[model samples]
Target: MASEAAATGSTNTGILGWIERSGNKLPDPVFLFFWLIGILIVISVIASLAGWAVQHPTELTEAGEPVVIAATSLLAAENIQRLWVDMPTTFTHFHPLGYVLVVMLGAGVAERAGLFGTAMRAGVRNAPTALLTPIVVLVGMLGNLAADAAYVVLIPLAGIIFHAAGRHPIAGIAASFAGVSGGFSANLLPGQLDALLFGITEASVETVFGDWTANIAGNWYFIAAMTFVFLPVIWFVTDRMIEPRLGKWNAEAAGNAMAEEQGDRPLTDGERMGLRWAGLAVLFVIGLWLLFTFGPGTPLIDEEATPEARLTPFYRSLVAGFFLLFLLAGWAYGKAAGVINDHRDLVKMMAGAMEDLAYYLVLAFAAAHFVAMFAWSNLGLVLAVNGADFLSSSGLPAWALLAAIILVSGLLNLFVGSASAKWALLAPVLVPMLMLLGISPEMATAAYRVGDSATNIITPLMVYFPLILIFCQRWQKDFGLGSLAATMLPYSIGLMLVGLALTIGWVALDLPLGPGASVFQEIPGTVNPVAPAAAQ
Candidate 1:
């Protein structure tokens, strides 16, 4: 039956099909932004012409009247001068651009040297059959710390591992995909994503409060909780709902059973040795960061500042810390595995990493300009202030507002899968608007992640969606894109329901999202919530 369907089915249909069609019709994210820039310019002109204006939510005039702001046309002489003159500066100063490139610089070497694959394999190699799904799900979630390596390595390994364990290979694939992409933001540790999203958030926050900086770890605790909460959700859906429907595995019926074996192969002695060295590299990098933070001199600390402010430098150093950790670990593994013959080989791998990011560099250019022009036009501010006013007046509680953010973010994920690109677009409005309502940018970011992660698996527009579909077809042959979406639907719905509940519960509890990060924030242009003041 699976083979027959595989032979007959031609294209995607239903909701997934519509999404694929719509998304396909849209320009590439790079071009999408180029088009959006044009649209924004038109809107700015119209708004400027119509005399659209709003009272500054927080700014005050010298006489204490609310400062009124009118939209500035992007075509204004000054604006046009700024655009052409500052083009290079705008792209170079794009917030997430450096953070991603730096982190990936190290990650790419580690990937090339085979460290990420070995680690992922070691994670599930010997799990008991009863424990396989949970372990795979957990690893998939944890694998996020390794970035995109999880997608390229673990999911296929899972299919092979499951087949070797006598279960349906597709079940393994679904479970892995569910945890990896669907649970993209659920991790105990902050990685490149934290840097990327927070960089964008800081840019948004700066428009309202220039002195503010985003702590990349702002959503750490929330995402940590997300991991545990989502683990069982993926586990249950895969084992009970998805697997039963997939039925028992019959290799004969399985089409193109993936010219596979990496998962089945035992770690070579060299691989094991390399793993040990990489583990030590991680310890060394972490210990070095610890020394910088807590050892004598404490260059990463500022003695004259308040406690939170003192740790600001330390928080900022994590980005570099991650780069070193990956670079050293990858180099160590490559040396042990004989993959990197020398320093020149290391340079080549690092260069390859940036080469892979060419698309992101292009996308970032469009996004940076959009963000800059949006700030220049005063349109984001106008929208944020008025939007906040409407929401605050609507009388919905804070949790409902956040829940709405989650749903909207989830909806948007269906059309735009680049997390950084979308966050760069949304954060300008979402962050400042929520800040007006006494919600922190941290809380808003958390909500966006919850929505974004839960919907990743079900969305055909997600860049990796086609890859996941192909993985399914390798096992079942009959799995069309819709079939892939259908199999993953239960996992998506389960994750969404659970994720939403958790967000509401977190807000209700007023749990601190991370160290020095809270569910509420002092509105911009107002008092800071020092620990002592917060206690009072």
Candidate 2:
């Protein structure tokens, strides 16, 4: 007994040593993202001043149609001048600080009020060890519907739960991280990210197919199918492959105590009532949203109306709705739970939520500015046209093109963590090009989603990567980018393979990608010359 006790002490000390070392090696998340953003701005300014981006359009419109408008860059001072100012502003415009803060307000309420923790405990506690991998993966995948909360809460809790379960907590951390980040697009629900991507797809598809509509559910089934495929692959790799290689965790490295969570007060009578009311409030809010979205003549649904007349864009921008639902739910819960006694508590909750997001705000401001500049420079469009021509002339198979797309998207994810931003950059090119080949835009969107999601866990560019690293430090102490990369590599490969395989399966089945979007079709008014491209 004495020997065993001594060994345990030594082991714990080793673990703590590892964690401390890892923390020292890794760059701070806030600082890293901020630096990258700053660097991008500097490069954009240099290019603008160097006058290297000058390209005049040979023809502004094709076939007397308004479909193609090339930027006359470098050739005109007016073009370069506009690009200089507008480029950085793009990044700022989309990552709305106020919107992010408002959304976090609702999120903070649920987190602070014990709802998130309670739910997490309930989930991990009930899951059997054998089912743990799939369960963790599924939970993380589903959590995407809630936006960034998975990073904000789930990742750390996963480490704690694993430690309590008498297992290597880093394995647990990797599994959850895999599901949450790598499987981001695999959620059953079409959340804000989907809407953003679909909007870009719709706009791009319109160049070839005027009536193109990228529904929110465009990638739903593809994502769902990948979800199941990924779960087992993650389970097998993490349990049999990754964990075995990882060995035992040191004792001192047992991770943060589960004790802080232990004495948390149970829901009081008033709080219970508040929870019920909050649940109803949530239901009521969702009901109203559904009514507006699905109801006939409801402005939110667009009722077969024109772009201005349609509700598509309105429904697509559901982040505001997400903010409202949580706000009302949090308010009601706080009221019943007695945690919120007055308007002051409400204000405090919102303030607390906004405060933690300061780092994200800084990063987002720079990113937004960069994206704005990129768009203004028209480089993205020009690059897309040239790339599309190359792909077309190569006469490659659809599978080959898709495989290339997946690889390209995965590589791009290493630099750009925001899914929407990447899709925005890629969609305008991929969607229209794919349409010309007789491939549906929906399929293109699905392919992009798979690639974007697969690499998120391993990418330092992801906004949440540092947060995940910090969570890991609480358990292993030695964990760093290499550690995280090593641990997550298996899950990443699994998701990528399974996701890509499922995509190929969908194409083989000749299934509908979404409403009015199919994998293959004949080009309009052309029977002999089949449109060789697939709609992305």
Candidate whose TM-score is highest:
1
**Could you give the C-alpha RMSD of every candidate to the true structure, in order shown?**
5.3, 8.0
lDDT of 1 by residue, 1-536 (tens): 33333333336566766786787687788888888899999999987877777777667899987777778999999999999999999999877888888899998999889898899899998889999999999999989877778987899889988887889988999999999998999999888888899989988987765657778888999999999999999999999998899888897664333534334578898899999999999999989988998999999899999976898898778889889999999999999988999999999999999998888888899999999999899888778877887787799999999999889888888888888878887999999889988999999999999999988998777767777777777776667867888898999899989989999999999999987799997766532111111123
In model 2, where is the ten-residue run with the lowest total lDDT?
527-536
Q: Lowest-scoring 10 consecutive residues by lDDT in candidate 1?
A: 526-535
Instruction: Give the clash count for each candidate.
Output: 0, 28
What's the TM-score of each model vs. the native?
0.94, 0.71
Residue-by-residue lDDT tens digits, candidate 2, 393-459: 7898676777778889987777666676577557766765665556677788888988998988866
| Candidate topping lDDT | 1
Candidate 1, pairs of clashing residues: none
* Overall lDDT per candidate, in order of appearance: 0.85, 0.64
